[model samples]
Target chain A: MERPPHFICIQLPANPEYVLIVRLAVSGLANRLDFPYEEIEDIKLAVSEACNSIIAGSPPGSLILVECDSDGKTFEILVKTQSVDENDGALVPGSEQDMGLHIIRALMDDMEYLAKPGSGAVIRIRKNMSA
Target chain B: MDIKVDKRKVEEGLGIVDILGEIDVYTSSWVKEAIAEFIKEGNYNIIINLEGVRYIDSTGLGVLIGALKRVKEHEGSISLICTNPQIKKIFNITGLSKIFAIYKSEEEALAAHKEG
Candidate 1:
């Protein structure tokens, strides 16, 4: 049987404080899932790093959408920001100049980048909950 | 997130700090300050309680390592009470769990301190 989807989207303000908001939400969700304290923290940091990536863009917009899904065993976090398919060197993920890329990679099980169908940049973070 | 630091008298003059909060980039300074403040006060027996903190990052790990360095310079002591596996992984990844004494609980850390 296919798993039920557990998803939620948070409209974040383009600000650093929003990082804290994402942290709090992820922490709470992790807690509800009975995630180990340390794993919960890991999730929290992953979410924060993702949000920070968007925050670095400092795009002139409100609401950086964060979609989350959990299957009681793994958690998938997606942060969609205002951007189209423009690899502006400054925003490239694997560049030596970007700190967020390294942090996100180190903290999560898997990280994927996708340009929105119409517009924007979306980063997805997936992690195993029981691992 | 909230961080409250505690200071207590120790037989060997070890400094201890109670860390309460998510230890991410946004809040790691709170831990850094606790250790820095202790070092400045000339105390080195440090035992950080992670029973309260659920999240930690490399920045957070780096800060802990920094504190450990400061304590080592003065021949001081630093330990950790990590109840969460996630925080434990960070320490393990950074090889800090080997350098710093990590206990299962605050009581165990304090007991080990007494034996040392």
Candidate 2:
């Protein structure tokens, strides 16, 4: 039998000021998981980039939800935001948003993107302890 | 959460911008504005000292890229001094290491500036 994953979640206004809070929270969680210093930095950067993309693409007053879970061997992060304007959340090629996505992809072991019919954009990233 | 950007002249035409603290979405604007001010004052060759920076995100990297473009228009260049392994890793992973000149110390960056 597998043990249950540890979970942590944060919800904040889609404001840039709150990004630090999210980063700190994720850092603390990763530290508790005993992630190496380098991997912890990578996780922090990936999460920050996700938040930046969501905040930039979402509509005003939008809220960002970040969820993290770890099972000692694997760590996962999910960032979600709701947007009324689909086009507003679309990633423009060669834009900063595109670059941000590239950075996240390079740092994380795996990354997936989803656009729910009415829920908006979601970015899921994962890291393996041994990777 | 907070950042401090200080600008000083290295020579008649060269200046250095020293940044301390974290550079994220919220604090990157301050860095951008400080670099813009340096360009406005006709200083082109600039060295950005990031030794004191503990964290920088893609937004912070974007600010550096933008500043590089603005300075390049004046035939100026932007060199970076970063010693932190984590910060250096970000530049390498993003392939920005190839685009910008990075040095481990201010002295080396200054020598390179003088050589040009």
Candidate 3:
């Protein structure tokens, strides 16, 4: 049997103003995990981009769910969108919004996007501890 | 996460806008507006001093790029004074280091602007 991963989740209004707070929180958490200063900055930027992506795609008054977990060797985060309109899926490749996803991909070790029409989209990113 | 823009005239028709704070999705528009307003005021030659910026995301980068494009449209030039290693890293990551004329100090950027 696998042990449960240590996780922390935060829910905030889908407003761009709250992205700075999320960046600071993730910075602190990454520091405690012994990530170097540069790596912490990487995490901060990646997480901020992920949150902003949700804010741009979803409608106003939506909520963003951020879940971060660590399993000793790697860190995983999921920025799940809530109540996103199905028709606003214009974050196609090469567009301006897609640049955020590309930045996240460059900063993190691995990433995957799960889009759920009429509901929400989930962006999952993983970073190895030793990388 | 408050952003403060300090605008000062550096030379004839030149201004230096020093942005102090994290530039993200929330605050980037403010930076963009400040630059746009400067362009509107006929200060075509501008240099953005980013020595005090602690963080910047893709939106922030986009704002700078947009400002550059606008200045170019007016036959003006824009240089960047960015000393922070992290900010430089982001610029390099986005291939903006090659696109913009980046210098280590404000004086250097001003000299470069004067040369051209």
**DockQ for all models:** 0.20, 0.78, 0.74
Ranking by lDDT: 2, 3, 1
* lDDT string, candidate 3, A1-131, tens digits: 55454677788998998998889888888988889999999999999988987776565678998888898899988886755332446523223347788888888999877665445566778989984
Decide which is better by TM-score, 1 or 3. 3
lDDT tens digits by residue: candidate 3, B1-116: 48998888876678999999889899998988988998888878888999989988999999988988888888888889998898898888888899988999987987888778
Evaluated at residue A23, the lDDT of candidate 1 is 81
lDDT of 3: 0.83
In model 3, how large is the Cα lDDT of residue A104? 89
Q: How close to the true structure is residue B55 of candidate 3, measured as C-alpha lDDT? A: 86
RMSD of 1: 5.8
Best by TM-score: 3
Q: List the per-model TM-score of the A chain.
A: 0.76, 0.80, 0.81
Model 2 ranges with Cα > 4 A deviation: A1-5, A82-97, A116-119
Question: What TM-score does candidate 2 get on C-alpha atoms?
Answer: 0.90
Report the number of the highest-lDDT candidate.
2
* Cα-based lDDT at residue A90, candidate 1: 41
What TM-score would candidate 3 get against the native? 0.90
**Candidate 2 CAPRI classification by DockQ:** medium
Give the poorly placed runs of model 3, Cα more than 4 Å off. A1-5, A83-97
TM-score of chain A of 2: 0.80
C-alpha positional error of residue B55 in candidate 3 after TM-score superposition, expressed in Å:
0.4
Model 2 agreement with the true structure over B3-99: per-residue lDDT tens digits: 9998999778799999999999999998898899988998888999999999998889999999999989989999999989999988998899999
DockQ of 1: 0.20
